[model samples]
Target: MRALALASLLFFSAPPPAAAVAPPRDAYPDVARAYWVELDGKPLWAGQPDKRLPMASLAKLMTALLIAENADLAAKVTISRGAQQETGSRLGLRSGDTARAGDLLTATLVRSANDACRALADWRGGDQPRFVAMMNARAAKLGLRNTHFADACGHDAPTQYSSVRDLALLARAAMKQRAIVDAARLPSFRFRSGAGREYRMNNTNALIGRYEGARGLKTGYTPGAGRCLIALADREGHEVLAVLLHAPERWWDSIGLLELAFDEAKRRSRR
Candidate 1:
């Protein structure tokens, strides 16, 4: 009886053979190479969040933020030669062309217009360098430690870089602006140059229309950045934000991320 009791005690005290702990779920596929966080006011998931890469045109999201915060929307800004001639996805504004800051913002958010970004940045900080400084300052204030800015339009600047987490923070901040949110969801828009030529721009974020509860967000691409997207969606009374960086196929990756986020959100809600 004594030997049997000692054996039972040892069996119970040996940590029960150490029950296995399940591996954490991988929120993103390996091909997409992403970081995702689902928060019902708290972080529920994270993966490779600190990996920094070029944001491409997603940097314009911060550009729009600074413009909305510092410049008057209704205020008219004259395009400078630098702004008017900026390459890559332009709204075709002329050097002498003029438009309201509000309209330029719409172009920037909805179209990712490089020229519009330049014009807005120039208007806000009087030049690109000064505007970049302001962007870095704002990012610091927002606690985006892994982000840095070299240009407003996110053209190929050697120093321009941001992480998925930082982009998500920028997206959240940009969403607060009604104008930006509205512009981001727009399917299409038309803008006229000073010479009366109309230029039409479309929303680059494909997820906005096809995904349920999807709202305005941003898309970016460059050789160095690959494809990137920041997406926001609300499902079943829960709001989810997803960020993907260096994705080969941005739209598909965004959809997959959103689906996972919504699934997790729904499960948590039920619990």
Candidate 2:
């Protein structure tokens, strides 16, 4: 009984266990309102990925994808009066102007040109509403329950919204088309309209030609959508795709996330 009493006293006097040290911060901190990172087809990290939010001009990805899948690249698309009046990030196309379907797709994806996007939509669906219906239908087919589109060029709208997760899916589907992959990676695109006018535009994605291994993808911004991006990179046969929505510092955050994702992948491989 005396020995038991002594042991209990020692147990009570022993130093308490040290409090667990938390990491400096979350794996990602304030990266975005919604973000998702994937490496080699596996999820690496995500934050509020399924929360539907304004996508801005990233909606052009679906427009470009649908064009790649259904429209003949060589076909001519006549710019309508409505397409000419499209606001924000325009390719300066005028009414009665014509451009190749593929060129319009390139301008749409690379420059986030709303005029080019609306022209493509008009050519494909005969009207914006019809094209939006097709976009929603494609979203449904892809199982993107959290996505919907009220505009072809991603103007701020109450009904147009998509999640980071859904954007990732949409980006992947769009990248599968060679034309999209080609256009998105270009640093600049130049095309001519039927009115003998030339349109030269730089890619909206800043990473192109700057970040090593950075490839085709998309970027967007609007008053409501803030900054959005679908960034893709390939290194040593490994692919990393990241989606960011409403990120105040999308370029820096995207670079940081891609670096962290690749580092994490390397660590996993070592294990």
Candidate 3:
């Protein structure tokens, strides 16, 4: 009984475990100027998140979001001459081509097809400018304070701009839509041209198949925008959204940023 009492006293008198120290934020190398936000049960690391920059193809996220919100995916749309003539990262769709809204959306999101995006906008909003207005409206509704849309296909325009933080919000909102998520996550997809030619389209978001836990997002580049990426990844019940703007090497920067985010999340989870 004396021994037991002594042991109990010792246990009660023992010091508590040492408090955990957080990893320093500077541990991650400066790969690019970036803005990261964790949402829907995730974490964020941001830099100059509100600085507006040309979005390039990442603007398609907004286009996809608008299409998913306003149009039935199964609806058919006739490809216009204007849509066919759009340049940059296209599937070579021709004028007078017709395809289902779902297929066009798949092309737009997975392949970053400029022609497909323009077709979707024309079909949904009756014209490119009107569609851009809708995109701006959607941005307003989403509370994206630093975003503006000048074109539907992310073609270079003086007014087309978005910040990393704003794009993160857009990506998060788009992920909530099943169709958008499905289209974004595909490694590769097929779209039937207006002329019934089969075109195999691959995702521009290189991280989808290359990185563990990577799902969907977008990539962009222009002489003005540099290289940009909005990347999403899921791991161990945690989701992270990372955005890089004007990155000299987008793929390398994105991978580095994601690695940092995952490490930070894990470190916090153990605390």
Question: Top model by TM-score, which number?
Answer: 2
Please estimate how well model 1 matches the true structure, expressed as its whole-model Cα lDDT.
0.76
- lDDT string for model 2 (1-271, tens) is 2334433432333221111212112235367788888878766667787788999998989999899999999999999888999998997899897999999999998889999999999989999999999999999999998999999999999999999888989988997899999999999989887777999999889999999899969999999999999999987678999999988878877887776666656666666
Positional deviation of 87 in candidate 3, in angstroms?
A: 0.7
Clashes of 1: 0
Q: Give the per-residue lDDT of model 1 (tens digit) for 158-267.
A: 78998877777888788888888888888888866556768787788887678888886888888888887777888778877777777775665556556655666665
What is the overall TM-score of model 3 with all chains considered together?
0.86
TM-score of each: 0.86, 0.89, 0.86
Best by lDDT: 2
| Order of candidate numbers by lDDT, starting with the best | 2, 3, 1
Of the pair 2 and 3, which is ahead by lDDT?
A: 2
Model 2 local distance difference test score: 0.85
Report residue 226 deviation for candidate 2 (angstroms).
0.3
What local lDDT does model 3 show for residue 201?
75
Which stretches of candidate 1 lie above 4 Å from their native place? Answer: 1-26, 29-31, 193-195
Cα deviation of 130 in candidate 3 (Å)? 0.6
